[model samples]
Target: MTTALIRPTADLYDSWAAAVNEFDGVHIDGSGLQAPVVPGRVTLDALIRDAAVLADTTVAPPEDRVHNDLYWIVDDREVVGFLSFRHTLNDWLREAGGHIGYAVRPSRRRQGYASAALALALDRAREIGLERVFITCDDDNVASARTIERAGGVLQDISDQTERGHSLLRRYWIAL
Candidate 1:
């Protein structure tokens, strides 16, 4: 199946909601969705609005945040995952978050969605004139590490100190 990244929209709410439900209490990285996302508590309209705001580079991000673009990873007509591309790294991002973040829906794992999305994101980074992008994954997340490596990500080092709620993080840099 061909995978593509698109901005979040109201039209894909049903599929997006279903994917969100599949997350349960786990964090859906790259998805700008707020935590403890109860089904009825979050509306498609509100999410769409928030996504728009996050993607608006004209608007200044908060002191600790950087301007970012959020994209839903779609395969066919299904919302299979999400990706976030930060235009610049903040101090916290420099340590852990990196230039991009993404997550494949739990049900869609191991189907090449993430790898495809990462490849596409690298293209986007190049388009934006970035020479390279920094990425990080949990030290225990072997699958993600492999995904990064497959994308030509060179391992920098693993940090054991806590940063942005992650204790052990493996950092990499992917040259565009």
Candidate 2:
């Protein structure tokens, strides 16, 4: 199935939250996951707010938010996954975050959603003046690595990240 990358909407947010809540097996990482509510209002609000940040270029937020937190949605009917983009040359971003991030819904895993969604996002990145993109996956996440590789990502290096308690990060880059 084809997936389109678009801006996040209220309905999309709702669906994303519902998917997260319903799919207990898929570990939704990134932001605001510790709250008691599965598909909580607070999380939705944050998603909306972040979308606004990505859209607004005038009054950009702090370096991390500006360089790292901006994301675009790959909504396949509902928001099945998200693609985040940042300039890899940025110091902090290159070290830990990289240029892109993504996740597929648990129920939607093993399908081509992640690879397809990432390709769409890479087009967006190139449109935004990026010649290449840096992406990272946990070393243990073979699926993620495969998705990246399938999307034409070339391995840069393997590094250990202490933030997630010794999780290894497999970094890759896709030249646009």
Candidate 3:
């Protein structure tokens, strides 16, 4: 029941509101949207706005770019588990955000959703002509590291991402 990234329909927004209200770990999938966002009905418009930067010549070219949202149909409802991306991991991106991000609802974790979602996202990344992509996880996030490993992610470096007082960042790379 996966659908291409599109404007948030009324039904989709309503479902997203309900799911995220009760599920803190479940992030709204916005990679599929026209821009980068937290993936929620509340931020849809803003996300679209950020994505508009792509139209500027100052930004990188738009080829081989695809954003994706990971939605899980639970009890006949669409519960967004996480969002990932298939895009260019520029120098800045390599240092911080990497190429993907994901989260699973606390109540729905340990059920393999993140693993499945990431695997799917990586497949899409390969389809977009990425020979390899960088993905970062918190050093303490064993679950996330395992998910990356399952997707064939190889450890690259562990750097302190505390410039703004954040935690350690572990970088990995996966070959398509």
Candidate 4:
């Protein structure tokens, strides 16, 4: 399957919603969608609007957030995952969030979509003139750690304390 990252669009609402609903209350890390997704609560128009706002650097972000580029991971015409590339790191990001975040739909996990998407994100990061990027995953998420390592990420350190939804974060840096 041909995997690519595309900006979220209204035309793919049905496909995106289907994949998102499968999360069953789990957080979709990179999706701009609100956490613990309430089925039927997120409208397509709202999602499209939110995505536009997130991608618009001119628009000031909320106090605790940074401007980010959000993309939907598509395999051909289906939305299988989401990714967020922060333009700059905020305090929280420096501690845990990192420069890039991503999540594959439950059904799409272990299929290499995350790897392909991360590779694509890295290319975009380079094109935007980033010298390197920081990334983190839960220490227990062996698959994600492997994905980052495969992308040339070197381990920095693991956070000593739990932050947010993650128990312990494995931080890595990929030099571009």
Clashing pairs in 1: none
Give TM-scores for every candidate, taking all chains together and pairing residue i with residue i.
0.93, 0.81, 0.70, 0.92
lDDT tens digits, residue span 1-176, model 4: 79999887877877988988888877788887777775453565676677777678777986788878889999988999999998889988998889999999989899999999999999988988899999999999999999999999999998965536568889999999
Which runs of model 1 end up more than 4 angstroms from their true locations?
40-43, 161-163
Give per-residue lDDT, candidate 4, residue 106: 85
Tens digit per residue, CA lDDT, model 3, 100-157? 7766656677877777667767776777788888888888989988998988999998
Q: Compared to the true structure, candidate 2 yields what TM-score? A: 0.81
Lowest lDDT block of 10, candidate 2: 28-37
**lDDT computed for candidate 2:** 0.68
Quote the positional error of residue 55 for candidate 3 in Å.
10
Runs of candidate 4 with Cα error greater than 4 angstroms are 39-42
Better of 1 and 3 by TM-score: 1
TM-score: which is higher, 1 or 2? 1
- How good is model 3 by TM-score? 0.70
Of the candidates numbered 1 and 2, which has the greater lDDT value?
Answer: 1
Model 1 poorest ten-residue lDDT run: 36-45
